[model samples]
Target: MQTQIKKWGNSAVVRLPATMLAQLNLSVGSPVDLKTEGDRLVIEPSLNREYKLSDLLEGITPDNLHESIDWGEAVGREVAA
Candidate 1:
């Protein structure tokens, strides 16, 4: 399928067909990664990962909740207790 590259303000824009977009599960405001492979333009979903609260705290339990760290004395302007 051929598409036209139209002028958008000062840059060129190629609008993807609705069918193609639907096939890729992409809708308006979806993030995508674009790159040039040799002479081809490749578009892929962004690698940005989204996690739920449960996913982030899965391995954290009460046993490790209050684990202390030996972060040596603050060298900067820190208020000493």
Candidate 2:
């Protein structure tokens, strides 16, 4: 499939067809990485991985834990310890 790059404000943009996006499981506002491979332009989904709170907490251990620092006495209406 071929697409035309059109001028959008000061940037050139290509409108991908809905069918193409659906095939790739992508939609509007989806993160994507664009790069040039040789003479062809390549567009792929970003490799950003989402982390779960539970999974992150499981990775914490006493070996990597640190003690909290005391920031002196609170002058304003801060929560008391």
Candidate 3:
């Protein structure tokens, strides 16, 4: 689809069609990366790293673990038992 670039405030903007946006699963406020390759402009969804639980727990062992803290008693206000 062809879109004309129009001036919006101090920047030039090209509106993407609803169909294109749907195909790309992009919505308003979605982050996008833009770059110019030679004379061509490339637009893509910004990459976000989604870390796995295993990866986050990597290298974590009991040897490096700290003892759990215990709140001895409810010194402040206490609710019904």
Candidate 4:
């Protein structure tokens, strides 16, 4: 289905048809990556960049709950001091 391009203030906006929107799984406020290929333009969804566990774990410190352990009397002795 073909859609019409209307004048929006200082720029022209293309109102995508309902069929094309449904086929492309696009909705309002969705980010689109537009590029020019030869004489035509291509529009698609942008790649979502996500952070890793290292990013989320920044400035986090490990607990030292076992700092009171004692192993001086016997080989297998691990009594908490």
Scored by lDDT, the top model is 2
Q: On a 0 to 100 scale, what is the lDDT of residue 3 in model 1?
A: 88
Clash number by candidate, in order: 0, 0, 0, 0
Deviation from native of the Cα of residue 62 in model 2, angstroms? 38
Please, what are the lDDT tens digits per residue for candidate 3 over residues 1-81? 678999999999999988888999999889999999999999999999798999978968989977989868787777456
Residue-wise C-alpha lDDT for candidate 4, range 1-81, written one tens digit per residue? 566779999998888876777888888778999899999878888879797999867745576333566546755546555
Stretches off by above 4 angstroms in model 1 are: 49-81
Pairs that collide, model 4: none
Model 3 RMSD in Å is 9.8
Q: How do the candidates rank by TM-score, highest first?
A: 2, 3, 1, 4
**Candidate 4: worst 10 consecutive residues by lDDT?**
63-72
Q: Model 2, residue 35: what's the lDDT?
A: 99
> 1-81 in candidate 2: lDDT tens per residue?
877999999999999999999999999999999999999999999988899999999998999988999999889889756
Question: Model 3: runs farther than 4 Å from truth?
Answer: 49-81
Model 1, residue 57: distance off in Å is 27
The total of clashing pairs for model 3 equals 0
Badly placed stretches (over 4 Å) of model 4 are 50-81
Clashing residue pairs, backbone N/CA/C < 3 A, model 2: none
